[model samples]
Target chain A: MPQTHDDVAETTPARADVVEMVGLHGFVQLAAFARLATDAEHAPDLRAQVTISRMAAGELAALDQLETVARRVGADLYEAMASYSTVLADFDRRTPPGDWWERVVRTYVAYGVLADLQRVLSRAVAPDGRPMLDDVIADSGYEDFVVAMLGPVVAADQQLSARLALWGRRVVGEALGIAQRLLAEHPLLWSFADRQDGARSEGDDAAWLRKQLSGGHARRMGRLGLTA
Target chain B: MPQTHDDVAETTPARADVVEMVGLHGFVQLAAFARLATDAEHAPDLRAQVTISRMAAGELAALDQLETVARRVGADLYEAMASYSTVLADFDRRTPPGDWWERVVRTYVAYGVLADLQRVLSRAVAPDGRPMLDDVIADSGYEDFVVAMLGPVVAADQQLSARLALWGRRVVGEALGIAQRLLAEHPLLWSFADRQDGARSEGDDAAWLRKQLSGGHARRMGRLGLTA
Candidate 1:
């Protein structure tokens, strides 16, 4: 157990499950980037469209690093990601975005939750994997670009601002539901995080995670001048 | 007009049409890149998928330089591209891809012809704009990647090989038809290309361009061990 709240405090011996966890994270990245690229097609202006596309390229560049991590661990990158494709895709199919605005909101909100989950999983990884996971999650790089781009656009139109706020709230609801379901499916990943939080019981840790997820969204929405 | 076979022999003073021509080329690059990113979604395997996505990123990178060219000429990039959007989209809507293979083939063949057309227009740009156009056309950087990635895959399956070759033929036909229509609609662009070829009549120049396009495809198909 960690004497202090630091991922490096515990030398958790990573096993096969770490490979699957990383693979799922890699796939999540692929989905996020692909969505950005697709949404660029519908952007209202050329600058907006091209900027979004370039941001997507940045996201894909990060995916390349995740792949590098998989290779270092001797995991077949494709096999690592293949299993989680359905559950992730199903989450999307179940709560399909109605339009470009809804889609963007979903990605923004859900990625925040997903990144939090990945962070929880990070402490459970062997120290070698932690740095890679840390770099990937610190995806604060593009999150800033997205927020900057969206903030002014959303501020410019009162009706659009209101609609996005509502859409964002709905997205958080769907994301919360999906996260709960994901924990049930990925028990090994959950167990890793659970073990890392030895100070708290399983229920306590789960509740804390849910709080982090929602709390993160509320803060992000607030930043965008919207309520979660 | 050039006294020799070079684009820079005479300073053909570029005017408003230069902006529109560059804008159309930018839009074409955008379409080509967007198509790559989309086709990546249906790639047969993970390596193929990730590689295609990265290649799309490369194509997008090339677009950034085109935008730079747009800015240099004081072209409102969005408005410059807007008028031609309908015609471009119409060509796409009329000949939508049946599957991933068809879509890839369309981008490959159509892009070759489009690149050839742009090179002709590149000769017409003011010497300052010509270098940007040249760099963007030399987008041979990723074109080689597509051929390398695709060649082995096509060669592996006899049926796929035959289908792709036939599909390539169909794409060239559609592309040639589109190219002819595009010339009729944008007389200013064609006139520049016409004047650049001082020795050839307009009909002869058009015939030579078509030969270059098809000839390019035939050789590419040969490299892939498929009949163009």
Candidate 2:
């Protein structure tokens, strides 16, 4: 059994493990965001989004020998990374954007939804892993930035809010579409998700994920000062 | 008036400065590469090049924070980074590749030359900066990977070398093409480039850059086991 973060309250695993895991996840997430940013041609205001994402990616590789260990653990962390990667790849392949705001909105939809899911999932990992996950979540400034960006646009134009709300809904829909496929195809990750609730049935985890997404959608809408 | 790395010897300032400059440069370089990786259709082995480039980008971002501080002390340093970044952005925009090998050759031609230039330029920076530059250069791992990927293709099909040679020539042409525009537009960078040779003219720098490109082209050809 992996030691939970709460278990070693006094001394952390020398801070190195936290650094390593956080760094790896950070890299994966950032690269995912960078891919989204490319598609966010409509969101020129969010060009910095990709830059931040790339920074996250670089951090993962910088974790000394931790990256090697992450791979060796058979966690398939890299594969897990590539799995999420397809979300962005699909976005790139199907719809290369012509406008800036569309690009930003797409990014806001894709990365924002994924980040929220990871934020919650990180909590279910083992204790030692929890700290690392916490660190990863902590470093991701995407949530705050997205909310900030959405605030003004919604405040100025109610139509923008409505359109973005619909966009957000579609984003979640597409994301869930992908998640369902991933769950079916990747039994280990599905098992991991199932173990999050100590439930034997995957249905329990699926229900839990649905509730989280609904809540997330509500929070995102509120952030935009819109009605979901 | 800037402190040379040698002047600082093996003391903290020397090491700290070297690391800082290199770290920032690395960060910018990685970010630039990630942007390029998104254009992987232009590369020969899309998946591998993208993976390597993304890894390099992430590693650059994860360097110690102390290093970031050291590199930001002078506007000159930032300016050099910005100049390189501009070159990258232009390359990205003008010649977005539709094929994989073209992208690989572009990476080889672009980063390969920049790495070589960095190797030489690091010597001119303060002695404290050299080690950090060296560290980044060592960690990049791109050159070896590129050579390995290029080797098999070259040995089995001489046409691969010929095509890549042509591609390499185009990258240099585009890079120098942009450099000329930058020289005309950014007098500050041009002046700095001249100062490197103790009052060499801007024209002199252009001449030197051409010579550097010529030599790099030859080296790349040799690595591909081709006659230049």
lDDT of 2 by residue, A1-228 (tens): 122244443334333333334333434455553554343322342235334444345333332232433443433334334444444456455544335544555555555556555565453344454432234443445556766866787789977767766666666677666555544544444323422346556787677776766677677668767666
Looking at model 1 chain A, report the run of 10 residues with the lowest lDDT sum: A1-10
* Native contacts recovered, each model: 0.59, 0.14
Which pairs clash (backbone N, Cα, C closer than 3 Å) in model 1?
none
Q: Model 2 Cα displacement at B159 (Å)?
A: 2.1
Error of 2 at A162 (Å): 2.5
Error of 2 at A191 (Å): 2.7
Candidate 2 docking classification:
incorrect
Location of the lowest summed lDDT over 10 successive residues in candidate 2 chain A: A37-46
- Docking quality tier of model 1: medium
Q: Write the per-residue lDDT of candidate 2 for residues B130-216, one digit (tens) a residue.
A: 432234444456666767976787788877767766776777777657545544544433322313456367677777766765687
Which runs of model 1 end up more than 4 angstroms from their true locations? Answer: A1-14, A124-134, A138-163, A191-202, B1-14, B124-134, B138-160, B191-196, B199-202
Q: For every candidate structure, what is the RMSD over all alpha carbons to the true structure, in angstroms? A: 5.8, 7.9
Q: Residue by residue across B1-228, what tens digits does model 1's lDDT show?
A: 112213342344335676667676777777766777888888877777777787777766556555555566666666676666665566677668888767777777787778777766665445565433555654635567667877888878999989888888877888887777676667666545633446356687667667766777787668767788
lDDT of 1 by residue, A111-212 (tens): 777777777666544556544354565463556766787788787889988988888877787787777776666766664563433635667766877886
Worst 10 residues of 1 chain B by lDDT: B1-10
